[model samples]
Target: MKNKKAVVYVRLKEGVLDPQGVTIQRAILNMGYDVVEGVRSGRFFELELADGNGDLSGKVEEICRKLLANPVIEDFSVEYT
Candidate 1:
């Protein structure tokens, strides 16, 4: 059987106010990192699944779309290996 791995990345939609990112950017500027412009935060998820001949990809995507991400405010992608 082949081993399967899933990698998920979640990020806030564009135009959203990212207070954390803004705060980090300000700190960097204060620390003399003049070239630092901005920062954005996101989430990463790694999952392992038993080999199932590609049957689990759809289910995983569904999980991400329905529960892991807010469809109105976030976007996510899943990669399998």
Candidate 2:
């Protein structure tokens, strides 16, 4: 069996205020770089899983919703590789 990895990506939802993103965008503009219009920040987690049945995806999704991400203010996406 091949090894697998689950990558969970977390980001603030649309219409939500992101102070870190705003700060980074301002700093970029202040540096005289007009090429950048906006910036958004996010986080990701990598989980190593044993080769098992097809239930790994579902488990990772549940983990993200329950612990890794805040469902009210943030959204999460998962990828298996």
Candidate 3:
């Protein structure tokens, strides 16, 4: 029985138009931050699981694949700590 911590990160797939990121980068440049080359926005999720069997990773992965991420346009990664 182990208490597990999970971190899920979701990001837009490459080749997708990220207007928000582009806009932010432009704004940074305007603010005199010339070294800011690019920007990409993503999401982070931290969770704790109380499963005794040590099978939480599979379940969390499934949850991310099914609900947290759109398989066609997004990518996700899970880390257990």
Candidate 4:
């Protein structure tokens, strides 16, 4: 079987407050990189998956929604590589 990899991206949805991102943006400004107007922080998970029933994507998305991300405050996207 061929190897399969998945990357799950998790980020705050729009209109949500991101204190960490705001802090990073402030630090960048303090460092004299004035070109950066804003910043948004996010996280990703790399999953090494075994190819099984041709529905890996669906399962991954379900995993993301149920475990990796908070459906109310965060949005998630999945990428297969």
TM-scores, in order shown? 0.85, 0.89, 0.89, 0.90
For all candidates in order, the CA lDDT equals 0.84, 0.89, 0.88, 0.89
Best by TM-score: 4
Per-residue lDDT tens digits for candidate 2, residues 1-81, read 343998899999999999999999999999999998889999999999887665677778889999999999999998878
Assess the local accuracy of residue 53 in candidate 3 as a C-alpha lDDT between 0 and 100.
Answer: 66
Alpha carbon lDDT at 10, candidate 2: 99
Q: Which stretches of candidate 1 lie over 4 Å from their true place?
A: 1-3
lDDT of 1 by residue, 1-81 (tens): 343888889999999888889999999999989997779988889988876565687878898998888889888988877
TM-score, cand. 4 vs. native: 0.90
- Regions of candidate 3 where Cα sits further than 4 Å from its true position: 1-3
**Looking at model 3, which ten-residue stretch has the lowest summed lDDT?**
50-59
- Candidate 2 vs candidate 4: the TM-score winner is 4
Write down the RMSD of all candidates, one decimal each: 2.0, 1.8, 1.5, 1.9
By the lDDT metric, which is better: model 1 or model 4?
Answer: 4
Residue pairs with backbone overlap in model 4: none
